[model samples]
Target: MGGCVSVSSRSTCSSRSNGERISPSCLWIDMFRRKRSRRTFSDHVTTLQHLSSIPSRIFTNGRSSSACIFTQQGRKGINQDAMIVWEDFMAEDVTFCGVFDGHGPYGHLVARKVRDTLPLKLSSFFDSFGSKQNGSGANCCNGNMKSDVADPVKETSTEDRVESLWREAFLKSYKAMDKELRSHPNLDCFCSGSTAVTVIKQGSNLFMGNIGDSRAILGSKDSNDSMVAIQLTVDLKPDLPREAERIKRCKGRVFALQDEPEVQRVWLPFDDAPGLAMARAFGDFCLKEYGVISIPEFSHRVLSDQDKFVVLASDGVWDVLSNEEVVEIVSSAPTRSSAARILVESAAREWKAKYPTSKMDDCAVVCLFLDGKMDSESDYEEQGFSSATLQSNHSGNVVESDDGQNSEPCLQRNFTVRSSEENDQYRRVPIDADVEDAENGGTEDQNWSGLEGVTRVNSLVQLPRFSEERPRP
Candidate 1:
């Protein structure tokens, strides 16, 4: 016979300047005392964000989380469809969790390119979010008590600032990626881009964002204190109702190409390119020009004490494993990183189960386990210089030197080099009248495209003269 179990607790109260009493909510979090599975909280605890910030600790017991990624190259034969990327960032203020899945030939290239630049972009966004949200502070005090105003205010203020930074970081990084891809000639062939689903963990807060089909799920400890699965980021596919409406606006059509329960394939340019299923992605210049919008759906949420861990996977992994099944395997593992490996392995196992003779597609999984420090032990020791730990002065620039005397402004750059043979092969003519004879030395189209990879990325070389706004440190 099942019966209801009620539990409650009392805490001290305080008063605020508004003369109202405040108290922390008495959360009736259920404890799973038995072996039963917990309820899924994907529908609840909405809103999540992702950003580049300080690194988070990897392990608690002096053991670092090991990452494992396997690429099978698939049964479809030549691994033509590439869609897997996994990056683990261990930092001070937060942990960078990212998974970028690409389609077609250039998906991997675009994913790799964006992955390296995300943190710098995030740093730029955090500065913006922090400025907007933390001004004059947020309201911290609430109901019935009046004396403990300062504590609540401090707590709320801190949380707001942290959450804001995380959210803005993601939005900015995504926008930057979109902008960067626009002018890149190397990305010309990358008409099909990638889906990125990432999360940054800071203390008890989790900031996550998703673009395209890749996903992130939170496995929370249920009422019985047993772990349960919760989806943090929504999958941005044309199959979803809201997403469908968005697609319609952009003159796109989505069709379910496969008959899988959990897996749904949607496409645009429906009559011809039915295989490009994901509605939103980075690059895919052809889609952009054809009015196929690729706006990402982002969310930001705080993980409660009940949260067990998070699982991030590509469509390759999710194609074979259901959310519940994935959660079970992941939650059973001793650590999050292990759970990530197990999830990928489970996908491979399922592929083997289905097609004993066929090879499987590339698969990747990353798990983030969130639990308090055991015995107040730190998960990671302070290591090399972290971008998050650096404090900026009143001028809003990070003073690299301890004495604030010799710090150089950080510049984001990418450089490429080519071999002499390729350079000679793609030799181009100079068009400047000042170099007349030399200008006509080569063919009309010398095809410097060969020198493309070796060229520096997006150098807006024409310098615009501007008045200096602030003094350098």
Candidate 2:
């Protein structure tokens, strides 16, 4: 499989004595560039300083059959949804992809941290397991056995061990990731947490770990030769029976307000401090004792030839677009690399149209090709999505039908994406305090005094009630 990775990783460097700064997500200076380069230190430093002026506005995610990823921030504000696609993640024939949606104050930071470290931890744990399994008569995955060695482990289908190993790896990696998030000296995980939906692909096997509402879905051709979208995740939302049960058993509250009665959210039992949409996640230490957990739900699958690709995305994409619409857009895109971006752009437009009074959610996605090819024909017009818009169902909830026809009241305006240049003011490195207030289910410029009655972990601040009907500033 060919990978299309466009990102070039830069080395890390200490802060210069001179007054200059870079965005936290931007390129870092290489301290050893002078040593590696035949150039002098003065020349390297000069080059580094010159590059510092450019803000990383675009992420060209893959090398170009490598897993592809693209993210677009919504008009809502700062993007807290962080996603990753790592092809050749460790050993050959392995790829790891994940989407993390952060919420509450400092959520972007939490999502970023998890995106950066979770895969590494999983790899490390797998390495340890492999070492321990070596010479134990466990002969699979090359068995690492030398010809001179006495007994070579028996050969078997790759699927057998790969799935089991990853199940353990996902469980361990999530545990270690949560511990790191909790103990980090600089990070405040008290009221913030990130939902994670991740998948590791090796050959035809896929090992998935989900903790929260971020989802993984597969677009495949079924036995009837008809295209179908299979949802790989049961979105761990508060409304799910098992999820709601666990929340209640652990003394947490799960309910919906009159304004948005269809949507249920998790609240702290004692004071309703953090009202989270998902039941499980990494971080949110404040709600840890009350029912929120960092533990992930694990699932494994064997990919068949009919499988075309898998899409992992945050709720921002799901909130606006239905499963079939998402598959239609991705399958019809001009190229696989652009599919994720197209999905995000469409979702951003829908967010504005459907929830006119509410702020949009940040969108991130990882699109992994199973059949490994991009379709040149992007004629989605015939596919029936071009004319589609958001409409109210019988329940009056905003939803776009799979067939691209609106039966109820619909928003018909074509949405314009907020340009990166126009969004520069909202993109912050260490996010502003007000951004925290806005991200944690508050209306823009929503009064902080309205939340004074609820108890919070870090401070007295409480979350303003999140309502889709509230007008955005």
- Candidate number achieving the greatest lDDT relative to the actual structure: 2
- TM per candidate: 0.57, 0.65
User: Which stretches of model 1 miss by more than 4 angstroms?
Assistant: 1-91, 131-165, 256-271, 289-291, 334-337, 355-359, 372-473
lDDT (10s digit) by residue, model 2, range 374-438: 33334323322221111221112223233212234211111223344433433222311342222
Candidate 1 residues 1-473, lDDT tens each? 00111111212232346875544311100011112222233421120112212133221112133232222333332222221222233233346666666554444456555554555456446544444543232233213234443355554544454545566667777878788777766564235466777776654456677777666777777888876766565555544445555666776655432222222233345443423455578876655644444455455565556776677776666655667778899767554433454566678788677534333545556655565221111322222112212233221222223221223321221111223443343324232212112123422221111111111111111122256889879
Find the 10 residues in a row with the least total lDDT in model 2. Answer: 24-33
Model 2 misplacement above 4 A: 1-63, 136-160, 373-473
